[model samples]
Target: MADRGAGTMSLPDDWPDHANAILALNRMGSFDWDLDAGLMVMDAQAHAIFDILPEEYDDRPETLAVRVPPNEARRLDATVSQALKDGSENYGAYFRIRRRDGTQQWTHTQGYIRRDETGRPRRIIGVVRDATQELADIATRRERLEQDTALREQTNVVQLTTAALAHARTVQDVIDVLKDTHGLTHLGATSLVMGLVEAGRVRLIAEGPAGSFVAGTDVTGIDEPYPMNEVVRTLSPRFIESPEEFAAGYPILWPHITDLRITSAAYLPLIVQARPIGAMGLLYNDRRGFTAEERNILVALGSSIAQSLQRAMFYEQEKDIAQGLQQAMLPRTIPSVRGADVAVRYRAAAIGGSQGRDIGGDWYDLIPLPGGRVGAVIGDVQGHDTHAAAVMGQLRIVLRAYAAEGHTPATVMARASVFLHELDTDRFATCLYAEADLATGVVQVVRAGHIDPLLRHADRSCRRIPVPGGLPLGLSAEFGSLEYPVSTVELDPGHTLLLCTDGLVEMPGSDLDDGMRTLTALIASGPEDVRRLADMLIDLAEERGGDDDVALLLLHRRGLDAPVGGGRLQQHVAPGDPEALHEARHMVRAAVHTWGARDRADEIELIADELITNALMHTEGAAIVTLRALAGGRRLRVEVEDSSSALPRRREAGESGVSGRGLLLVDLLTDDWGVEARGGGKCVWCEFDVPESDRRRPNRRR
Candidate 1:
């Protein structure tokens, strides 16, 4: 054992035991320093810390300091000095030292300083231990903290993006959100390209970043289809990781895509009802790879977008078909009455907005009566869409039949009301039926829960015709009691009768009185003809209350002598028995020759004979035929009237039906042939092309 300074206590001979015990228990070593003698002492465990033998120590503090690494020596000296200067009893610091074997070790040194009575440092004693494990542990904790922070930030971004996508209203909106977010993070552009399958075309409805691809360039002529086309065709999704692969697989899009600098893309099919309507292509500007989570999010968003687009398309198609069917159900042309000029006008709703299928229960008709009288009707069913149109058609036919059978306006409406109530057609309807006797200028009207018709006399004053009775048709068993009163008014020359549907009176932002006022003002404007009046009334309604579908019919009674036979007639012919055909041919030839139509007499005679004879044989009744030469050289019309009211249906040639062959013949021979209803019967009519040369001939009455 070495002798130490006065303040240092000499270690016992058994010090090794304590030293060894400390080393085994805590992997630590012990050391001491003598300030006065400048001597240092270390246990065998301390020697082991530096990989040096305990016998190598010279028992001198200066010698030990010389053995310490230069950097560690300075650090230890500074700590010891600080403790002594502060007159502290203990001090500690961590330092790095090199072992004899040239390995570095981190260590902590703690010391106790002995002070004189005045609290000045005299000597110092301490122990040093290896701390490499603690340092390593701290480093690991710092790395873990950094990793966790990054993961949390990514999760927050994903959650925000998902919420944004979920709330998007349209596919375009969803694509926009995705494109914007993706561009913010990835510094790339995005685009949504759609392929319309039915049209065999592609369109880009929404494009992000550049937004220049929104109109879509045609890639249909490409040799191979794009992945989006395949996805739609196969009902699957595809991801293209490389531009080269895309160009190889879809050569047509290669030129366009190469210019776009799209390095990565995804193609998703937009499917509805198990059928593909189109494909959505998501393009990225740089080569990119999607993780499983990101791909899942995109797929879900694609499906949602597809469903929304499909819903919008279905709504549009349904509206279009309904509107088309409704228009087809309406009468194409008003029947020309001998003693009255008639006109009608119908307008459809604008496209794409919520005003779907402008078809409603509104309807109108003009029926020619005995003694140059004309019957005009305007009515509304209780609903809209196809059901209403069907109901209106039924009412129209029934009322026309009743009027042609000579029923008075009141009696006609009474019977119609009862028929409607008892009829199995599960619909309720309203109507205003009126009959104008042109010879006496007496107008008779009946209203069945319908708006009263307006009358504008030659004095330019307007009034609602008084027909105050009846409930809407199909409402009750006692509908006959609700029969409208027959109101009669003597017509003055040049007076006009205007019949309209509720769509006219029930315009938006206006009450019944306001509508009446508007309509009366319109009538006072004094249009030139019934056609002009009908058009103006509908226009006025639209200006005031365009929320509904409008239907109007106007009638102006003309003097009995006003150009009675001014319009021309057209004739169509079919195959029939030779004898009847020949007799009809002779009549046609004689009529045409009498009218000095020598140039077309032969063609007209042949066409008329075939048409009349075919009507007589196949129409199942006595056929009444009439011929008229049209004005303005427009057409020559021939009408063969039959008692049978069953409409002539067109059929294929060689069919079992007896009428099939005749229609084929007519179609081959005539420019056009149509069947219309006459009073209590049907008329199969045809038109023939009259040459300009034949029209130039002078009229020579027979």
Candidate 2:
């Protein structure tokens, strides 16, 4: 190089090496200060450090002080004075200096103070290295670790909140679980409030700390704009870091902000499936700047929170309507038959694609036929919609009417099939009708294209019974005349018969034959009690991949091995035959006195008379009465059967004529009187249990 600058030490001929060395390391610049003159001489490197040119450099202490900020200048003076006072040979300090490029640079200088023979400082020489890049790299690494830790903490908070939300049942449950979750505070949330959008209004779901919110407060209208509305409208998170910003964006919430002493806050919008369901708000006592990563985490948490809240609200609303419809249409208790143990189960699916909570149109009915026989029927409409459910209810009424008209199983099935075909419904239904003669151990089955009934033999072997029948109800009209043929099977005591809809044996992505085999195995290896068996089947129907509703009916025949009780009495009285009343009276007297229930003899006799009389006069078929003794002769029960499904109401006693008081008489003369739906009709039955004192009397007629 030509003339390597004046007032500098002479370097080797290869000046490029020296320049490369300075460039590789931090640029080291030198300065000299004269103790007597109070001035400095800066090198070109030092001038570059100050973002200055050689022409702009000045050798004056005041000039250097002007470049150094007040704080750093004071630091410089203190360091140099202490070094001189302590008689130290060296002084060093790190400070910031203002540059001509409008940037501040971190600089560190170390100097040696030389003294003369009089013990006074003569001159000072120092070097300054710009540590800006190195220091910035160190700071960046530290901040990254902190951010990593915070992100982990935020992820943990989300996991904890998600676990708590699973068991939440309502919007309030969402708030309660969140309040109990302490991870939010760890994520810098001093306080939190959850709000839900409902009916065009913002309803406060819950707030932490006992008295944070008023009960049932709807923040619907406000005099000034609020940041919460901005979040909901934009579906974006907002971070307000100061009181002025909070007041400016949420003027309506200023009072609450003042009460909370809030200096900063965050509003994260809860969006689910691109729909804004609500928002979560976090409050802080100090202004905090949110990093991009932190805001991103909060946005994800908002989505999760919104998903859980929406799921809960939908479940609650759907269940209410389903339960109401089920209660109104279904029979409460299974009728007590004389020779068969009967059980029924119904399962409604809560989730079906597009069809939320509408229960499928699957129903089973028990009808008490003439001659001590029971008529059982189970049917299912083709679809699982509200329209299908309504159609099912109407079809139940028609089936009951036709069966009670003294028709055979085939006739009843044919009429019901024709009725549905003539109706205005767009769906079809499948049905299986069976007349079970408990007295004769004989069952007659008429199928209308429904699933075949399962017959489990007393020897523990199971098989499906085939029935030659016509098309499913509505389809019979479309295809041809109802060609239903009755099939008969005798239950040799200890045998079980099962009837169900297709839902019980259908699984996603599985063959129907496979489900049938599985069900057969379940039935053969299961318990004998009808109720327990029904429970197991219901569990199977609700397992994963089972998306349809199920309706099941089980009828079992008691073998002679069944434990013997006191004697039983049963009779059949043909309709419009007055002479059958005398026979019924004789049967009741023998049943009551045989069981030693003489005290309620007159009361039970009158109760049976009214029930049979009403049935014979209004109903088309016979009125049969049965008396059975239960609990070792301590309780006497009477059942008067009719071929009418219409239940008689307890009305005011007739003023003049001897009519309309049948139900009232039964109600007043018996311990219990109610109409049970069975055998395509109703059973008006009464039970007279002996009092504690009377149960011990030995054959007394008191």
For residues 192-299, write the lDDT of model 2, one tens digit per residue: 887777766666665645556633344753121555556777778899888888887766567664767778888988888887787788888865677787788887
- The TM-score between candidate 1 and the true structure equals 0.51
The C-alpha RMSD of each candidate to the native structure, in angstroms, is 16.3, 13.0
Find the candidate with the highest TM-score and give its number. 2
**Residue-wise C-alpha lDDT for candidate 1, range 1-702, written one tens digit per residue:** 245422234433534655557654787776767676667677666667656665666666556653478878888889888878876788999888777667778888787777778786666666777887887788788777865664455455555656665555444545565566542243232665665565555444544346344224544422236676678667888877788877887786577556677888878787777877767777787657665655665566566666667655665576677777666767767788755677887665432234345567677788876434578887777666777777777777888888886566876777777777777677777788878755446678778788888888777788877667578777733533654677887665677788887677765567987877777776878576777777777776656546467778887766544323333233333345455455556667766765556766655666666667656766655565666654334355677777667877666755456545666666776766777655467777776666777667776654
Off by over 4 Å in 2: 1-7, 10-280, 283-319, 352-355, 560-702
Q: Could you tell me the TM-score of candidate 2?
A: 0.54
Worst 10 residues of 2 by lDDT: 1-10
Candidate 2: how large is its RMSD? 13.0
**What is the Å distance of residue 695 in model 2 from its true position?**
29
For model 1, the local distance difference test gives 0.66
Steric clashes per prediction: 13, 7
lDDT of each: 0.66, 0.75
